[model samples]
Target: MTHAHFAPGRRTFLASMGAAAALLPFAGAGRAEGTSTTRRYVGLYFNGAWDVLLGPDPRDPAQSYDGIDLGTDALAAAYRDPIPVMMAGQEVLWGPTMASLAPHADVLTLFRGVNMNTVAHPAGRAYVNTFIPPSGVVPKGDSMGTRMAAAGAYGDLILPNVSIGMPTFNLVFPPDVTGVRLDRATEMTDLLEPLGDMPLSEATLAALRMAQDEVEGCVHEQYGRPPVEDLQIARDRMRQLLSNGYGESFDLAADADLKARYGITNPGASNDPAVIAATVWRLLETGLSRTITAQLQTGLDTHGPEWATQQPQRQQAGFDALAALLTDLRQDDPNLDDTTVVVFSEFARTPKINGRGGRDHHFAGSVLVFGGGLRRGVCGATLEQTLGLAAIDVATGQPDPAGRVLLPEDIGATLAHAAGLSHDPFRTDPLLDWIA
Candidate 1:
């Protein structure tokens, strides 16, 4: 495989996070109120560099090239021409593979010209996750999902951050906010189940619980109560997980109708894009987590002839799965409005295909955001000549001589702001115009 490599241990979760205090709503500070009232976030990431021209960004073949260079002898081409679609009354070009998403354009918030600033897979992936560049392949700070889990309106949910086959990091948040990592959806169901037969009868369990509560009460009365009372909360949450009906609710095989909708033939083990989409929906619907991140597609680091044939197909399948997930969310009124979804890849492919009939990594990339009361429109642009990122007016997302370049940090800040967080953790202002 001619793919980028990274340190394998980066995916390991922190096992010693101390229990976190009960979550409190983050202050909105003095930021202007946009229309977003969402408290939950869902991230769907493609594991490798993707060819944006076949999805969110494309050039028309029939039109004049003008200053842009198509390379006189390039061998591969997009399987189909770009399709022009009107989004928010503006004509936008959609690549052939993104057809499934055309119908949902009204809610789409496409951010183009995002400068990933690195072609290396590890750096780019880490950049997207935390909006902070890594230090020699080691991720810095907390992942966006972890921050959300710590600051969002988590209420009484036990698992605030659930990451399935996704790279999640936590360097600063409370230990309780650390992600509950799992390889697949089945693991979640298993984790919530009781172990073997009950070792103690109900009477004994009740007596033990009462005894602990009394001991904690006495400690609290003497110590003026631990500020967050987090340890006790953590204990209660663990008991709730073991005793609740969550085992049955999360059993993927129990819902035949849901399996059919997502085209899941093998429920627990499958990693199909559609199956991942369904898993996201299940997590959200059950109100089990405040933030969820999952890898929906992989093997996109195409550096050979397979680029033309395999890349576009994989991209399309992922888009189709996303569209299906949206449709399912629409079935329940207000579901879409309350949840925010983001789709992105580590980076983008080079504009010109290489001699090997494939493309290499590029710095400029695109991201798709929708739901959560966000407006539907494009937020930035790339230069036509080199397909490189262009500076844009942050307030309006338009090209200007004095404009600044867009970065993943801007997106992170925007999302944090929408979640009513007052702090500028990403050290950038949110794209105010992107708000509904």
Candidate 2:
């Protein structure tokens, strides 16, 4: 019923848990790597179902001039004449809002015919992130980000996994391997500089630190040996995070040009997806985190008259942010070749527009991937009449009557492999064709 229901002070709870874990004797054994040369994974989730016909459709002009339209002015205007763009030297029809991504087409790959099975928000979100379909609404295993953080090599990193404005079920991960959630980048600044308002005098600061240390020691004594060591490790980690200058990555005000490029401005009424994307980029670039997950602006559910105006704007904002992020990754990071970015919706919209000029939920959807040596091009197809999924040979990424339909599980498996993680734990097969 409220934002609290979805977020529920998750950031604070995680911070506290990390501090408690520091008190344990073996907590240091789970620390992440101080320096990692391996690749990073970033996930951008577009909440709600996105309309595939609005983006790229395989419909014939004879069957439907403009695929399926809900009759909204916005949809009609945008979808009436879909334009074809060359991506990775292949002709592909792109949605009006996707123009920003055209320049980076050489590295972009689109996957259609993704079967998500469910339209329910909770289940869909969980399934897409974790690759395991929800039994009744709860996730069965760790998400890809959590799994990547759990890898032994990343244990010493300050924050191996970072999630912002996204639904993350970390209970499935090991207690010390959990990710940190922040509602906004500003909150991250606050966490790193909790004493910003306190006295700056050396004596005053020292007294405050001593008081805090005394309290921590008292708590450790009360909790006994195991907890005491974990608490101590957590305290040392917090100090390392502050001293190592990792929090500086969250300072968006330093570079005005960079902020403008990512559409980040001073705080306003709502959080911008561009700023979130930029934050993820900075985290990876600075080695503050190895895996990051963020949600773009919601409201893609276009269930009524709102679809006429709201849906187009929402789609455009998401695409523009993504385009900027990709550009920065290529131009800014020296290790760009080692990073992978994935963007996808839980499912797609219905083929036929409903009476209210809106689309209902559909089982089939699409996904976009770039960087990390993935093959650049389009894969799979959809039928004209029903806009249903078309099976594709997993090995070749080509359409086949008897081929397997691409599913979220396959995407998850592919990502796991890209991160050099074991897919056997998840019991899913990777789409090897996408890997380069």
Q: Largest TM-score belongs to which candidate?
A: 1
* Runs off by more than 4 Å, candidate 2: 1-36, 56-67, 70-80, 171-176, 195-197, 200-233, 243-254, 332-336
Model 1 regions more than 4 Å off: 1-38, 64-78, 196-228, 333-335
Per-residue lDDT of model 2, residues 108-181, tens digit only: 77878888888888888888777767776776666656665654355466666777776655543444545677
RMSD (CA, Å), each prediction? 5.9, 5.0
lDDT of 1: 0.72
Distance from true location, Cα of 52 in model 1, Å: 0.4
TM-score, every prediction? 0.83, 0.83
Residues 1-436, candidate 1, lDDT per residue (tens digit)?
1111111121222121223222222232233455343367788888888898888988876765554433323324545677888888999998878988887887788889899889999888888777766776776667777777765545467677888786676654555666777776556666775555658889988997777555433334544554235656655766776787777766668888887777777776556787788878877787777688888888899888888777888888788888888777676644367668889998999887788878899988998987755677888888877787899887777776689888888888787676666436677787777766
Tell how far residue 385 is off in model 2, in angstroms.
Answer: 3.1
Give lDDT: candidate 1, residue 227: 28
